[model samples]
Target: MSVNPVVRISKVLSLLTVTLLVLAGVSACGTSSDSTQDTITIGASLSLKGDFSDSGLGLKKGYELWADNINKSGGLLGKQIKIDILDDGGTPAQVTTNINTLIHNHKDSLVLGEVITGLAIPGFETADRYGYAYISPGGLTGKITAAEKDDNKHNVFGISLPIKSYLSSFDQYVLSLPADQKPQTVAFMGSQSPFATQQLAFSKAEIGDKLKVVLDAGGSYPEETTDYTPMAQQVVNSKADIVVLGSGSSAEAGAFIKAFKQQHYNPKALIATGGPDEGKAFLDAVGGADTAEGVFVPNSGWYPQIKNYQNDVFTKSYVAKYGGTADEIASDTVQGYAAGQVLEQAVKKANSFDNAKLQDVLKSASFDTVQGPVQFDETDHTNKVAIPFLFQWLSGHLQAVYPANEAQANPEYPKKTW
Candidate 1:
């Protein structure tokens, strides 16, 4: 046995070769499951079909444009950028499933998801479970990200003005008026959904004695409610100096406003929160300037008059690419673009796609977007600063009329009485 030393050494070398081959094969197979180092992939769940399609489509287009532009700029970190998306039909349950599939089945690195607050809540949960950042373009209510008591909201951030912030801005607008010009009595009308409910509660707490509440018409109006005549009648009959439509679709808001006009209820100020208050659909539904004149809404990401160098460039390019003015682009469009901008900036700062590293950068940084400076509060993960302003419909154009410095046009108080 001692005379066979060379043969024994050759046998040991043969065993090492087989082991190395097996390990290499396993590594190759595992890498194939996720992706190669040649590209970075991100996924999202959107309400591409159903009641939320308008906002969802705008979001999709914004994301697509971002991806295209990044690829044109030679991509990120020397890798091509790819975005994968699924339609959730505006359902929270579906959004959960879509996000789960994207994480577990597709193994994506990050998710940009959901416009509706309800749907975005579950999306945030799913993204957290996967240990990825979930940035929302809409869904600004703090509750959506569990900012109250739960610490799980750290991975969720957004572009929409949070409920507290929006209410504060609205309250500031009311107080900005001279004592004689300000309305003494107001009514609150909105849907019973989480967003509207949270907004109303905050409004009451923030508004305090600044204005008297003469009517509380807000309730859980089902998404399917088409006729708002009863609610409109209630608001009009209250004879309040200001009537605030807390929540409704653009069409629903238009219906209620039309009914209010028909009833000859001419309040000094008319403001709305959702749908008819923010997007282009509101103008179309309310029959243009003739009917929508002097209406006010929280900026809600739709005002084209919020001027800045970045916003001006974005609006011009958006108009050129989409063949319409910046106003034609929904807030969701800008939101989607801003979300992408945030993601890009974070990735660039970290110089890698490692989720943990990206998270650290996002939590600690501020981004300059078309919407202005966007910084996430380190604790709540909700945006700490936003360019929220109150906008009014003047003639056929939307004009910013609050916060003094940001106002594009003076408010037309005591809108024409019917």
Candidate 2:
């Protein structure tokens, strides 16, 4: 018991070394098996607040509904799926930060896209930096697609139709009209936002010399401009046969509609880039079903009637969960759900959680969603299979009225006066 101090210290050190080796063995065993992992997390950064909040919330519902359905079906790859959504406040910088945290800190298995092109671009760039694929509900701007071509970054994919072609269907419908019914003068008014301006440009190019330009004021107002009465008054003054508004939201379109009504200026046709496609929100903004009637909005895909992949199931599930009729469902919600549908198919096809494998499957496969068949272009990653259609409000319902094959109803020309 009273042995030399040096010998006692040597015995204690030997015991400590043996204990460390035993603990290290346990750690190694756990690491090799990775048995504790039980869930696959998908993350998204959305403009849940700020300018895009309304659309952002719609997209959120879509994502949530998809995750709920997947979980109910026994989850993906035999593991429960969890979604981590963060609000970007409609800011690009915030989107970048949220994306990094999701990919690096949370170690999310996949990342979904934002609501608009401005917010989505940053999110896509950040995801690309980490070698992750970016699948968005919207954000089909030319810059993003061009970047994909010029930079060879085939990682960004859009669920919606390309921005430049959004109004192409409408143009074709107008040009096909009889000489007497054809509109002679056209007016273009839009926000400077990339999506709005691009649609305006495309409409002009497509219409060409067939229509005289009464007002070429597209991109005349800043995106943040709240008051549209002044610009709308100019359109009324021009006495244009047709008024094409490139609105960013239902509210913007509603403002213009209200102004036109006040001035008692009813053009032969009044169509907007957005707004009327938003269902109840658009109707409410334009002062109920009566005012909404005859308003036209181009649709990339997805109407309540189209029998696309799992659309019936999606519509029922959405109504059951959100308490709305199928017609009242926001198009943004469909876009969001379609984005998830793409991701789910890619994961199942690859049979692995690896981002690289998912990207490869996405590039080669054509997946069906509520928005119809989605096949991304190898170069731009934009959906190439879905055809854009023109939709108009008829008897309080948004009906596809163009592209004879896809038309749910005939075009309501020379729309009713407000």
Candidate 3:
């Protein structure tokens, strides 16, 4: 109907305003919804710099590898996976901050654990506060699991063997040796790191009485200590038959090894909680393979040749992507990939991206990864299905050598002189 020009103009303006408001609303909703529907973002804080940089970088590579593999083969739930990794600089405080920022920015993103236990603990706590599942690859200390028990933080899950049982296979193998071959005197040396300290405590309780305690320096020094000659001298002075070092990194282990070599102190057998299992990095840190000969380290069911879920693919992919032989692949890389595996399985099983739903699925489900089978204990969320193995540096490679059944090579006992 014909009307006044002024009235017609006012009505036209009103209609245009309403149309714009509806378009803005749809745009806002799409921005938020498309993020989740098109891509699943995962968050993690890693020690990409500082002391744990070597392992942290390896872990980052593994995470990226997993994401690449998933994206190439129809990503999780038909959506691409995006990993938002932040550098924690190997500090506990920064890890906490990184995790907080990650959760704050993307409330629905899942969290992957950090490299060291010290960093992972804070990361886990932050994720728990947000009620997000935290799947850790290298947080093996029992303290975290114990804290989870006390606080009932079932959101934290460890993909590696618990620290309490890290040395069980080594202990069993030593005890099974001939009476004369069995170490009669032992020394326990560990940095003040929770992972190392816990391993030291367990070692003392498990075999302290069986063997003469020559030196118990388990909690003698802080993890950041640069000089290890003093402690190495103590071990030499004690002249222990065997040395069990609760080292937390390849650098720490290398320091002690170099100190021992300088003093020409050689024990019948020397095993560390970490370091040697790091592959070529450990060998390089300790002055090549000859110097690392016969050293033992515990592994959480991962080796390049192990016949496990997609191990061949993972190894081949790692080599193709990183340009290194299978023997040089770091254990940290395997752990990181396994953590991704667990998360991928949980998402598919629940058929949901909700963190709460994924948590529930992880609690009761068993998953297989490059490492092996992973089934978390209902009470502690520690992996109970995978058995830790003792690996020794033999013929320039770290090979499994314990429990008779899993032995890839007979242990080179009475370790060769450095």
TM-score, cand. 2 vs. native: 0.91
Across residues 1-418, which tens digit of lDDT does each residue of candidate 1 receive?
3658898888999999999988865543212233456777789999888877767887898887777777878987777878899999988899999998887787676678776777888888777766677888864675675543475446777766676556556677777788889889988887766667677777777675678898876654766576777778888888999877776457777888888878888998887776544457778878777788888777544466555425765676677777766666666787888788888888899886766677888889888776677788776777777756787778777777887776777888888775
* lDDT, model 1: 0.74
* Per-residue lDDT over 277-366 for candidate 2, one digit per residue giving the tens place of the 0 to 100 score: 899999899898888888899978779989889998899999999997999998889999999999999989988766777789888899
Q: Which rank order by TM-score, best down to worst?
A: 2, 3, 1
How does residue 146 of candidate 1 score in lDDT?
59
Model 1 lowest lDDT segment of ten: 27-36
Q: Report residue 209 deviation for candidate 2 (angstroms).
A: 1.4
Identify the superior model by lDDT, candidate 2 or candidate 3: 2
Model 3's TM-score against the true structure: 0.91
Off by over 4 Å in 3: 1-36, 106-108, 150-152
lDDT of 2 at 75: 88
Worst 10 residues of 3 by lDDT: 27-36
